[model samples]
Target: MANALRTFDADVGSAPMDMLSALFEARGWQCDVHSTEEISGKVKGSWATYQLRCIWRREDNVLQLLCLPDIRVSPEKRAPATDLLALVNEQMWLGHFELWSDGGMLLFRHAAMLGDEGLLSLTQAQALVETAIEECDRFYPAFQFVLWSDKSPKDALTSAMVDAAGEA
Candidate 1:
């Protein structure tokens, strides 16, 4: 087996970070570009405030997103929370939520392998964030139901996904 060749341009070292910064800025997000390796911002959705963090691995051309939902899962609820996250993870397309048991914290995480290439595209950066927001927004209510309402994982997912309103 051989290692895959990275396609990133040597001169375009900042492409990924720059693209992320610009994309978040365009959305009026105040992001902290404290380092080339990471950029973070907070997006307030209708349901909860989400903290979005993007980390770039220059050596591998991999950009990963760590989105923390505002809710905190407690130790007592860890068992059911695991069930809830598992169900939601099965339904997700972009990322999955992980339980950091040490703190009973849950976070939605995803990564994009850009591979060795030229400068990252603005569209690519935007797509990553947009997908994250969409997935987080869609599933947040389910997490609430599990953590707060004592709802079963199956029912939580159903409540989160059900569209009761027919064509108006």
Candidate 2:
């Protein structure tokens, strides 16, 4: 695939957001360019299809990505979900999970600061999306266990950590 990110110079006002949209289009993600500063899409994972949103803050030179699984934590379950997030975030090398208190929506969030140059490579964008999705996939079952099955955060995390040696 061509690096859509490389096509634009910094002089282009919306270069970062434009390159982001092109990269998503090239990868055939269900991309929506909400505005010059935002893009949203869906990504299929082993456990679920995640909703992805990317927002570019020109003033701060920050590019933020949010990945959300198709699950909601009821008010009663938010405390346990919060525990699970703490456990889950502790182990991650990239994005961290967040539980929106008012709405009880769980999501993975990561942001990159582009500095004054305000440049992002396609590879960096890919990594940001992939890392969010991957971490969501890896921890999805734990969230299920906590929210639905009433497992303790530690136990749910333990259950989710088990890896099958090989496909049958």
Choose the strongest candidate by lDDT.
Answer: 2
Q: What lDDT score is found at residue 125 in candidate 1?
A: 67
lDDT (tens digit, per residue) of candidate 1 on 78-111: 8988998889888877778898867887888998
Please give the CA lDDT of all the candidate structures. 0.78, 0.83
RMSD in angstroms between candidate 1 and the native structure over all alpha carbons: 7.5
TM-score of 2: 0.88
Question: Which model scores highest in TM-score?
Answer: 2
Weakest 10 consecutive residues, lDDT, candidate 1?
A: 1-10
Worst 10 residues of 2 by lDDT: 5-14
Task: List TM-scores for all candidates, in order.
Answer: 0.86, 0.88
lDDT of 1: 0.78
Clashes of 1: 5
Alpha carbon lDDT at 93, candidate 1: 72
Residue-level error in angstroms, candidate 2, position 125: 0.6
